[model samples]
Target: MPRFPEVAESSVGLSDAVFSRLVARARERGGKVYPLHVGDTYLDPYEGARAEAIRSVDHQRLHNYSPVQGEPALLDAILAHVDRRSGAALDRELVQVVSGATAGIAVVVDSLLSPGDELLLLSPFWPLVRGTTQRRGARAIEVPFWDRLESMGDAAAVEAYLESFVTPRTSAIYVNTPHNPTGHILAARHLDAIASVAERHGLWVISDEVYEELWFDEEPASAWMHPRLRSRSVVVHSVSKAYGLAGARVGFVHGPATAMQAIRGVQTFVTYCAPRPFQLAAAKVLTEGRGWIASTRAHYRELAHRAADALDVPRPPGGTFLFVDTRGRRRDGESAFAFLERCVDRGVLLTPGTASGKDFEDWVRLCFTTLPPDDLHEALARLRQVLDDR
Candidate 1:
């Protein structure tokens, strides 16, 4: 028998401990399971999404492969939304849709990096960022966020890292604002500093702004608006979080015209195009569903606050997760995985920190976005009991 080499070894190794275990245990536990491990919104989908899907199927355009870059209507909608949000005159030529942000990231990595090139990564990251880049034979040189921040901000460390690590072999730097796993919104000064580093080093910035809409207080600053960084950056965003459309698998990559063209080239060999029906649905949400989007954001904000209050854990600035210090909460100094197992026994499934990176071994992420208010409250109660008892 012949064995084929794996195309995504690094990516496949970084298991999503919380999600996989929860699925198995939920099946075993049956009705007693209270799933708080997953980050999906328990909220209903936007009404416009449903109506638009019906309209799209009726129009027959949804049956065809969308324009190679994206369906024209969807591109226009993305451009209009960006213009309204950033006051920047974004052209439709700069937008390319993908299956989701993950696909967009893949295309960017493949288009930019050669094997053995180094990609500067900001950690603790989405894990897949490092995994995917590494799978392409690139090294992920990480600069830790909080440690670098000290009291200043992560931008300073970013600047320092670029100066020290960047070389001709360095191809790109990944930045995630309103970051996952840890919700650190990039500061304006940090972004400015990062832009200077990118300009000096001629490094590409792959900014994942998937959680840009989930801010609690202030609106997030767009790294795309930075003059020095605009032309060198690829901004990847998803409608999954904002529109409750994760299953739809819709996202877009907007950047300099040259890289946008390159992303299209990469997508041609990949998924080819975003699903036509989902793009049509996303277009409607971007154009005509501001009120519904606002309502959803407000609901998420309330849920974050409520869950934080119940857990008595300070909430991060923004994003769907509540990262908790689970250390010293279990007997015999149990590992995060063990603590997770105990919680599962009590019917609350949570994401263990080890999945994010090795540095977060004692931490665990509580997904507050899904589960109703009362259900979340009960889960928190059960979690507290499990922790206290242990």
Candidate 2:
């Protein structure tokens, strides 16, 4: 077997360890697996968007490589979409399309973080955030955003608490609004406070806004758009969730020209450009489909409430996933791993909290968007049975 580096060997494994066992059991029983453990939508792409991709492929757009920055039409459409949706004035020079938000984030971390540097990450993060930082020979120092949200309720207090976590080696701050796992959407005012702290500390900010369009009751905001933070911030966005186009692998990052210039070279070495037709298709979705996204937001909001009420947990503020405490499900002398094993045995699959963060070992994250109402409700009901038995 081939060996790996010390860092690679030491890094946490992100596999849904329990889900694999669940898949095995499903095969053994020849029954449908209740899939509530993924962040993808089961819905089809909008007709207009699908047709655009087909049209491009039919005409052979996929055969050509795109500009290193982005397809011009796609970049223009992104600028317009961001301007209309977020009210941010951005110049064309500041934007560059990469693969997906995941790759865009990797590009940002690779560009900004250096060896022996530290990145301050809001904790219980997307988990891959750690790999992105560590792979660059940098460090991701996770600060618990939810713990701070609870202990320091005020925006100013939360900002100060975040500052306390910083060290001299810190190079940047990575934050996600409508955060994955917790679904905690940072308020505009809270984001402003974070921006202020970043400005004062002379920190670059990488804002993950992939879930920006999924907010339930609140208007979404990003740290990159704040007047104080704009010059030092990069925002990563994608069409995966809002437009049901994860397969397209189209995402972009926008920042001041100074940072974009640096990131462009790195992106060239890494992903070069997103698939040409995917970029054009995403542009079509952005330019042609706003009603679809608005309705999706409404549907997820209602479903979030339904799931939360059924699980007896608080409603997720945004995003398609929900992190629920499964501590109560443990039986005598059983660990959370054991609880999760039992859940799989009962035919319901969840991402065990171990994969996300050590601090969340007693929790499980559910993705409610992939299943229809009936399936989701059935899955949750099965989860309740597993939790209640013994």
lDDT of 1: 0.78
| Candidate 1 per-residue C-alpha lDDT over 301-369 given as tens digits, one digit per residue, 9 for 90 to 100 | 888888777777776678888877776667786767777777887888887775566677787787788
Instruction: For each candidate in the order shown, give its overall lDDT on alpha carbons.
Output: 0.78, 0.81
* Pairs in steric clash, model 2: none
lDDT of 1 at 385: 89
Q: 1-390, model 2: which lDDT tens digit per residue?
A: 225633353245534344576557656765667878778887877777774445643655565899999989898899899998789878888889999988889898889888889998777778677877877878878776653465566768877788898888988988787888888877666777788778787999898889888889867556466677777878899998878999889999998787899899899999899988888889888998888888888998988898888888899889998888776656877888777767777777788775566678888888989898888889989888887786
Name the lDDT value of residue 45 in candidate 1.
73
User: Candidate 1 clashing pairs?
Assistant: none
Every model's TM-score: 0.90, 0.91
How much does each candidate deviate from the true structure in C-alpha RMSD? 2.7, 2.8
Error of 1 at 344 (Å): 1.3
